[model samples]
Target: MREITTVGVIGLGTMGAGIVEVFAKAGLSVVGVDGTPELAERGRGFLEASTGRAVAKGRLSEEDQAAVLGRVTWSHRLTDLAGADLVVEAVPERMEIKRDIFTTLDGIVREDAILASNTSSLSLTEIAAATAQPQRVIGMHFFNPAPVLALVEVITTLLTDDEVTGAVRELAVRLGKKPVVVGDRAGFVANALLITYLARAIRMYETGHVSREDIDAAGKVGIGLPMGPLTLADLIGLDVVKEVCDVLYAATHEPSAAPPALLQQLVTVGRLGRKTGQGFYAYEKPGSGVVTDAPEAVGRPGAASSVAVVGTGDLATDLVDRLTAAGTTVTAVDDPGADTASLAGTPVVVLVGGPEGSCEDCGSGDCLIAEGVDPSDATACECCHGTAPEAWFGAVAESLDSRTVLVPTDEPSAWALLGRIDPEVQVVPVAVHRPTRSGSLVEVARQIDGDDGAVRSVDATFAAAGFVTLVTRDRAGLVVDALLYPHLNDAVRMLDSGYAGAADIDTAMTAGCGYPQGPFAMIDEIGADEVADGLTDMQTETGDPALSPSPLLVEHAVANRSFLG
Candidate 1:
């Protein structure tokens, strides 16, 4: 492989300047080129401002900052790249503009010099087709704020030489980047999955399924993402997100890739997210991160004063403690065998365990018994005979008359148990796990109630029970798991398909998205079999191929071996 010493960066915009800084900081001489002297100077100013901030924050000494600045030379002429070992084009997302630049660079640069495009979602083949030396052209796609991010996608087209790919990958490693080699597909790996997820969030918002704040909260608290999809879109600039969505949709024709109507409308009105101080949420100012919300048009629903907590074990204990701490009147009944008379006047009831018995034996007499039934009446002991209490509708008929019931069960069981309840009873199925982050709340499947105010009341009840709430539709995996499991399954498929190794895929997601752990690591932590089962169930419900569990995942699950092990 040829060594890369001097790098030439064209179109010194935000991405271009960051790329130049990354190379310069790695001790490579960089020629930052732009369309004119003014743009070149502006790019230089951006570089100086970035370095100055670093110095002010004590991230870099003054001497080191000066050295980084000294290594970069700004110019307006493409001919200045004649001695460059590699030329990276970071121009706008226009095929004609990029083709023109690559064509000019082909004539100006040395015969062996590599040419790369820092495009997030454009076709490398089409860009290379404009040059005579197509075999030398590849993609070195970097994440935004390239100097701060570590992931570099090295895209290889059909005509791209193996040596050229290897050289670029090596150069990325030398510049403190984790490079993953991928095919020249639209959005590649990260953005392909990311765009689909973002589109789903927008659809959820547009359809009035959940509030914007709760949706964002779900992503942050449920999964360990650095930011929610909408907030990230705002930070990324909605205009750019729309463009990428358009490019992906045009390439794959996947409905999930199409930009939602709401996104387009926001862009049309010039409310381009944080860049323009408005998008999904209002920002303090243009390019600001601080967010503020106007007073909600509808007021919050009233809170419930009294709640009955039933079932046994740690989950029940936690719920009782939380409810007690929240200052709500809590009637704690650990014995499911207790008469329903104790739960008569409670306005809300939280069932902690699922339909199946919470104890070790199936015949454990822990089911909720009716008030007037004799304990020895075999006919009325359906719960002890492996039937859920909700199945015995007559048993809880009195309790359900005027009260709201909250069942915190697994996603698959939520619907089945909820379906058995009387239609007149207000029931909400919630998937509650131990909080992943501090102050994170449980996810409430709100479609069961079909009223925003009713859902809010349930949310308030949960709050009174000492839990935060994220309201979502009564979907198979709820919000967090629905978006999260499919992405993990996709990562597994990527490993199974030989696109990349487990370690590399893990590295890519963590470095690319600021996730606390990569997909494989999460799979191992969650148990391979559990992850596989969840994906299989989701796939069956949604019919999305992305949700299908990889065969490797199934095999590992069957063998009870960790992916990492």
Candidate 2:
């Protein structure tokens, strides 16, 4: 309960040393212990080097570095932590190893001192049971690069006392990290959802559905992730990923977390990632883990002179922006009033929204239109939208005699469109490599131009990931608004079902799911009507009573008149 002036960090590995550095910089004296004095000294050296790097980067002053390094006292003996007010065990994630350390700490540290684990995959309850005071044991999972990555998961087990949980949350905030308290679930929240997603991605690759680069491209470009899961796995070390997967699978009994065959093989071969020389793709840069390929490009001389982007949704807007960015002339039009002037002197490509239907130029594969350069080879409804537009696009592309490239935004849509497209039509989904601040294709194009890179290659990456298509697909729900609405409605449903209070549900999801905002707050941010429309779409698609739009959602959507409202 007292202010933690002295802290003990057991085990001084990569994560351990980082933890020590974080605490020391926070002005807390640290007793960092390792198995041997040599290991302990190495830990101290890592701390010094990390702090020195900060000083070199102007993040920390020279004096501040010295002060921070001076705060940590490396020790080989467990008994050295006797004077500490708090102890965080960052030992290798093994039950016996952690149990052994906790057993030792129970005898050495003061009875009142709180004990925590930096174990990401291990059970907090089991670890706490090793100590006499199980109430003090909690999971304080700091992300990799402890001092830099902002989110800290504070896991509270059934046995973890509320006061201990509060203290850990306070400590995390004190260390300048965003803290979210969670229940002692397997992989907690982020890892549980993320690892499963990663496994599926790997499976998708292994099945030869998409290339490794394309998989990474889909995640980085399609979803706004800092790093693709493959790259992240490489950075974290493939061995560690495999181990984490094993632990999650063992704890949760879920097959999704079980490491896929390709993942295991890559780890086994030691092509771990940037750390190794190879992974999903050969890393041209050792420390940075950037990927490159020089395969012969395919599908040249396609007939796509000018395009008409139909629909006024976000997808259509993104398409207009992207097509313009790609140096292709584009015109946006509603069904009733088609602007023929915009299609002047260019072959028109119709981009339809929602499911495929009777196009204005149906049955006529080639609608001849007189222009400056002979009659144009007309392609009716170049693309379509919906949950699985890619299948439709794929089907359409396969049959086209003239070469044309059809782009789909996300996996479902792309796959749907892909099904309908001709096999010969070179399909390029958006797959961005670099980090993007904005999800919009227009912004990404600007970012590509602003940064020093081959514009053609960057454009290709966008095309590969389907960013060129501009329609973002929802994996769980049908559309963005629809996909998110049920979750928010579920939060409200939780309130109605007496599962938890509104604030508590929000708190849990924020801490538990890494949602930027809670469900109710999200409804306001995303607009109630938008959510309602999405739900209505989902309800129509699935015919599930549960998916029917909530009354509150209907009220809010109509009242606000916008999804964001």
Candidate 3:
């Protein structure tokens, strides 16, 4: 009800200090309190260094920076916040620590002063109930480097007053942030989608389905994300990522939301991402982003001389064009029987689940339709798209005698089609996800049942043809789709629950996680019907309930509607 002037912030860690910087730079008096004088002083250093950087960057004048510094009164005592109109706790994410801070602030700050928790995933309802004035308690979650990132999740519990929510939203806008007001749900919006996706990536790596570099690269190169999930987890601190995973899992009871053992083990050891200098990737030192680990040696690009492409789809056509431009003799035919004589020596490419035109920002194993490379080959069609073509299979593979069969699919059914081939075929299960600004990602299964020579050729050929290539084990969804679809499902579920609108969720992801497009945008681009069918197929293959399509997704698919519209 009153104008907010003096603000008190508890805990002056990286996030806490950034919060202090945001408010102080906005020309408001701030009191930043930590547990000890030393920690409090450390918090001061964080604020001063941040402001000093801004001055150096010419973003902030030295005089204004000094004034900003003048407004902040750092302390180790809670009593000093008596005059503050609002107090925000940025303590450790543990419940007891936050509860203690809220209880202390309830007794210290004025009754009208709003109490907010800068928690990423803890239950705001439980945190609010710790104090007598639950109406004033809310969640003001700011992403890391708070002064930089524009997303602030303003969360409200049932007890949180509308005025409290409005004031926080107003302050967030004043501080130059695009705030998404969400209910008091675990992980709220951003982390709910983000952390679960990160957990899936971790599980993929843990199972040795894909390499660490490739996992990061698939999302970065294939999906056009700023950083891959594993890289983000490392940057955010694995411990923090794991904590949020626990919170989300506790709330949803979804296995995908739970932290993988590898993540927990890494945190147990002192490898807490860039902070400790050793996380998924080896960094130069603590707090450094420079990765010191050697990238896996890949086959030289453009190694293959001749290939026969026997598929129909935009992705396959793109591959044919790129490969042809790279000087590889490509024998591509829409009819499998049309080019059967030339398929003996050349590698045969069966493009499965191909859409003539798709959303520009499709991601991860997004196979929508089976292009009739073998128009009459029902087995290949039925295997990938779950529908039989007019003609049965085997015409495409009739000539290949022990030659490499490159079947790019969204699932492991590539092997199914190749298995039906009578001859001894070296099946290289290829996975495709296209949505990059510059290139696409072609992921292959590591040589288990697949031929090592064929795998090596694929890496060389796809990479040389201007695509990101990753070779991993023959997992159900390969690399990209394994982490992507479930995340989209989570977004759909979140939207269905009415926690946050689709536009707000999209903004949160784009602004907070640096994704090229949010989940809903991606779904609309890829087609809801196709995505739901893909999920259904993947769920049938894997039997993982996490892969099941959200009912909202199915509804949208059935109606041919966009999640955004």
- TM-score of every model? 0.84, 0.68, 0.86
Q: Which stretches of candidate 1 lie over 4 Å from their true place?
A: 292-301, 336-340, 354-408, 411-425, 447-454, 464-466, 489-498, 520-565
Model 2 over residues 1-565: C-alpha lDDT tens digits? 5577899999898899999988998999999999999999999889988988888999999988889988889999998999998999998888899988888888988888889898887788888888888988889888777877667888888888888888888988899887767778667655654566566567656766345554554454444445555666777777777878888788757565689999999988887877776777677766555666425556323325455554445556666776677677676654423333333333333334332323322212221121232212222234222212222233334434323334343333333442244443444343222234424331122221122222233344345434522222222342223323554665554455453445554554455334445566766655576567667767787676766776756866667643222
lDDT of 1 by residue, 1-565 (tens): 8999999999899899999999999999999999999999999999999999999999999999999999999999999999999999999888899999999887899999999999888999999999999999999998888999899999999999999999999999999999999888888777876777788778778878777777777777777678888998998889888999999999878677899999999999999999899999898999888887744545345667777776656776777787788788887766545676656546677665543433222223234443455433322333344444333332343456545654544432232243344566666667775576546568877675465555677778776665667778787777777767767776777688776788877877788777778889988887787778778877788787766788988988889887777
lDDT per residue as tens, model 3, 517-540: 899999999789877877887899
Best by TM-score: 3
Name the better of 1 and 3 by lDDT. 3
Clashing pairs in 1: none
How many residue pairs clash in all the candidates, one count each? 0, 47, 6
| lDDT agreement of model 3 with the native | 0.79
